[model samples]
Target chain A: MQFVLKSVLISLVLVGAAFADGIKPEALSKDGAVTRDRHLTEIRDIMRGGRGGYIDFGFYYTPSREQLPLESQYGEHDGFAFNHHFAGFGAGEVARGRHMGALLWFDRSGWDGEDFFLFPHYNDFSLQRSVVTWGLTFTDARMDWTIAAGMQHQNLEHRGKIYPYEVDSLAYSWAHLRFSKLSAQANFYRTDWRLFRFSLDLESRAIYGGKKSGPLTYLPNVSLAMYNADEESDIDSMRITWEQNLYDQRLYAEVAIDLNDTWFHSAALKFYPDPSRMIGFEATCLNRVRMKQLSDDLVEEESDLLWGGAIDLLFARFAYNAAYDYENFFGAKGTFLVEFKFNLATIDGWLFNRGAARSAPMETDVVKQFDKNTKQSEITPMGSGSGAPKTIEAKGIRYEKAQPTATTEGGN
Target chain B: MKGTMKKISVLTVLLACCLTLSGCLTHWFVDSTTRLQIENRSSKTVVEIDILSEEDSDYKVWIRDTIRTGEKSRVYEEDWVGTFTMRVRTVGSDFDIENLKLDGGSEYMVLSDSTDGSLHYEFK
Candidate 1:
């Protein structure tokens, strides 16, 4: 653990240094005319930070899986996992994972789906567990409200060797698999008092391909209920959430997924306290605190608050993200992500140091000195101006005019 | 019945490829450091020179040092990029430099002491 932390710190310092290397201190953080520079009118527009969504490719090294075990059928898996967080598309995000996969909707009014490809039997290639789905979604005008339902198909393979016994476990099997169903969803969003915001999603799915459904064994436990391959089953779920933001969307929510098929709910709150994306904090609370328990025989069990955060950086063409997840069941897990996200149009120059997208270096300039008795220029602050902010050149950094702090009526 | 899924698989793969090909890298790659520096230009070394930012009437010090004449002292580092009110204090008197905008640039607040014991500065 110490090694991981140390390595991350070392990487941060190295990356910072690498980016700072080409920067000539005297060149820019711009020093423009006093009236314009003091107002800082262009901070929000600095480097086009908040424009379109970006496509991010990350290589993640996960060392702990007590909470959500990875490839359990295999050994205790802890290694580098290639992760693709695809955004910049229409409204939905299509992400693929090997052991597990899901495509979620940021704005449910759009289309979305989830397809999981579990294991291909070690001995038999044909006997594999997989679920595939494709569907369109509906969203409201505010963008906060949406509805989406995709085709949920599941082809679960229970080979004689894997299930050894006739009836293994229902919840375990259901997770590694899915059902062929037509899914429908509806989500409503509301923000009250401008601080408390919540959204609720209602989903109903109809199971398909339930042939002469096979043998069915359900434990008395509610969490283990499942439909016999011969019976028809569907999943109806509801999700309730409350969230807030801070620091101009940088350091957001500082406060705080699932059940197999029945009515399950989960909620999460995350904060990026540092606009630089170097530091983050988050806490999550979910309904199935029972399944992820450390022991099954506990007399009293309550939902758990799974919390985690990350420090991320992008410099000199290299991107690195380090995160720590604190799971009561898993204790603590360390994960590090490394990868480069490049624009398809600029891929040729993305990795090349001399690439076309590279920034031009400036000539070193001298810092002038003032002699005794020389009258200095008077400093004047720029007040409310009718002119739009102008982009200024600051040797190494780009900057703009500053504005007077606004007077917002509510919230601290 | 599972044919629908198979048919979409081909489309999903092709769409994924197109999206990947058009991915973007949007982080700012500008190379610069932020600092507020003050260089003493007078022949005689000045003792106890301080720089302060007064926002909302609250006084926050940026640079505090005994600047040897002709030398420079960095009063603040990673200074914010925006409007600001500043003050330069010398052993003799305090001078107010009001409403200076910083566009994330490195500029020396060159200061000179007049015979009347007043301090004046320029962004050199």
Candidate 2:
């Protein structure tokens, strides 16, 4: 681990030196005014050694929960053991030019071992994994073009508790093209694995009716295998996707299909009023058909259908996401997750903007309004003004201060 | 026929090169670098200095130190010296100079005789 860290640092220093000697201009002057050379001196003084990065640390523990079988009552056997996980992420960008920069990132996560039905014999077990990524990006502001290439290394846990001694490497390249009313990007990626995998993705966008109408976008992808572990396997697949924007760009409906032996199709609609607000619904079905011959020369076919939906909400810097999933193999299961994020800017020197701090009053107010509307049982004055509170009564239950425009909102 | 084709290809390549050269020559210019400083008055210290410029620009800055602290009735003299060239633009940004050691103890403790120990600078 120390060797890898040292190598990365040495490489960064060498690359930075090479880039510095190749891009800096001899002097800077504009028009007839030669702002005192002091300007250059001051600029140089300020541009030296800027460092910024993020650190995240959290612990999660899930207590064992009871599970009921389809035909039997709830079992009392010891449930899956509670596990603890830790993760860290760090990234830094070293500016090379006004529009060009180089970035390096390291991410690592690990968890203490817990019992698994599949590996029942194991007692105490643990897993550790980490990934390091480095890349350089160049942007041509005048031409609205950007190009980036990066390499990533993943060290995944192997057998027992030790991670893989040899790290897997992946390389990716991407380019973006921008136009007055349209933009497009093409990306290519390759990973070195037992069975090498590569992918190519293309996406395009078209603007209509300015920002209010949102942009029309389409993405179509196709990948071909250069090599596979099993030569008998299929070598190509294609996917087509389309999205229609509604309510400005806040809401969207999308449909997509993947064409292959195990053909899959799905359709989803989403409403994202803002980054902190969202509602979505989706349905999907996958068919995997195969022919089997019995000893008596009999043929049979089997199929399965899986579908689910999820809803996520973020308020006051806290996010709650819940999902309901069902499968023929696992029956029906529900998952809920809640997390609170600490805003580093709140404590950093850059927290204030023009002497005003960013406040979450609107977010808090919206959450409270939703909670009150759902729980209120008595009519009460909303407020004293032209837009005074409206009373809503149903089935002898009165909801005070109900908005006239209150409507049922539902999505997946 | 083959010889004639080769001659035509050569001329086409030469024309393309001439056009590209002309385009580049019309818009070649130098870029400038920016310097920024952050002073902490509460702490009477210089927190950071950053030099923002292209990677290849080779330049250096001179920082003069004038700080005094001590008894008002006594005569005192302070001399500062040292020159450092800017290197590595990629790492360029706010740099803390409090730890920079000079002929007179630590740079952060220099102040005028009438004032408390404080950070001061003269950029050139």
Candidate 3:
């Protein structure tokens, strides 16, 4: 029943607007100025210091389509302005491996669907989510790491008037769902490219761990997860990924295979024209193969493919995608996103060269000068009384010239 | 199903091969010798210079006699390899360079006296 509802809702939303493309399911940890991959950003924090803080606001729009899931109804489409707002702050010194950060994010999106089974019925559903997160980082002997945790609250509700469909089972006013979850994640970065990560969803008791290590040229990271610990089941999912960054981090390529009951894989490539990553271009391809049990002894298999690309400007981004769904839910879609970013400050990096200090060096210049003066006094003693030759002590290293007696030259 | 299973098998084998290769490439490829030259640029003479290795906690005396002003100490090749702490004593003040990593190359440590009667040192 839950799977049927989800499928219907997806199809309902598809009819009204082009589905947003290139937005991963993972919750973003920052204000979107940094890279979308949170793991890479964390590594950058330890390797190149951190971005202090920023705020971002984004708007999304899509065009309406005439085709509906029931084939007899039509849906209206509208764009949402300021659909997402995010603010975050992070700062630390990489050498000391000390960092702290916080984030607050809010997102809202709505879709409209209308159908005519017995009578014309209108359905308006809106999804609103709020998330708050905090993280702290510290250093170890060989690795620098951090731990972050967040809470997400979601509300899915039907808004505005719902026309009575004359059937008790088809009433839409009571349709609503509220979900809340707490999640925690930890990351350990040993070097620029070597890392380990762990995440846990507290409400669902789902846990995942991943590790990546190797040379910089080719690194493989793998993650494994179990959705529920109390249930009797094998591992529910495993993710195998290979990521590479080249040309001074201007080009990035990634291939990921996610295995569950179904087989899913995605390959994505991104290029950044500037160092700040305010402008970029990216493309992605996704494929999924699903197996379903039709009966006790029968099974069915289906495959879906999606390919998309996006161009991100400094303040706006445009994305388009073509999809082939086995159930023919989504065909093609375009999404327009406008974002504003404000950077509060930047974290300054400092060097750490502290250690146990030994004692100072021996034999100073004062001691050497004292010894030389004592030796000079012992080598020559001055005679006393009038008319006697006077002796002068030299303060500097250079000695005075000797004076010849005039009486000795006359006698010769 | 058969094709998916075959792809998973091939990727697993490739991951294992990469990890094994990483283990084999752990050792460094080159052997290097570091030559250090101490230059006394201060007005006062530097009497004694010492290099202490953090790994062994042993102090190797590099310069015992007085290094006169504007004079450069002979090239002192580091016999041991590791992070080292260096100490220099002049007539007026003492200078220190702590937790320094000297890799295969030539390094220079210049000791100079500041106007405020303090010692300044820099490694290049």
Docking class of 1: incorrect
Cα lDDT tens digits, model 3, B22-105, are 222221332134577878888888988776533344555766767899999888654322345766767676666665555434
Model 2, B7-108: lDDT tens per residue?
Answer: 999989965643442222211221011122222222332222222122224222223222112311122222111112222111122232332222222233
- Tens-place lDDT per residue, model 1, B1-124, is 5999988998899656444432221102221223677788864454543223222344544556777778888556642333345566555555666555554446777777668666667788
lDDT for each residue of candidate 2 in A1-412, tens digit (9 for 90 to 100): 9999999966754443233211001010010011111111111111111112223222111221112111111101111221111222222333332244444434333222222212222211223334454455454433434443344445543322212333333333333333322333333334322122122223222111122222322333222222222225433444444444544444555554555554454455555544112223333333334355554678775554433444433211111111112211112222222222121211112221110112122565578798888766555557744786686655677669866553556443
Q: Deviation in angstroms for B55 in model 3?
A: 77
Instruction: Pick the TM-score winner.
Output: 3
Poorly placed runs, candidate 1 (over 4 Å): A1-59, A62-88, A91-133, A137-239, A254-269, A273-307, A314-412, B1-124
Overall local distance difference test of candidate 2: 0.30
TM-score for all models, in order of appearance: 0.28, 0.34, 0.38
Q: How high is each candidate's interface RMSD, in Å?
A: 22.4, 32.6, 31.7
Question: Which lDDT tens digits does candidate 3 get at residues A1-412?
Answer: 9999999866755642444421211111111211122322332222222223444444333222122111101112221111333444445445544445554444432222221111111222111222222333332212323333333333333332222221111101100011121112322112111112232111110011111222332322223322221133444345555545544344667666665554457777878774335566778777756466788899898877667766777555555451211111122233332223222223232111010001112355468789988886563456545557776766669777776778567765
Which residue ranges in model 2 land beyond 4 Å of their true spot?
A: A1-98, A102-112, A115-128, A161-210, A214-237, A275-303, A315-334, A337-412, B1-124
DockQ of 1: 0.01
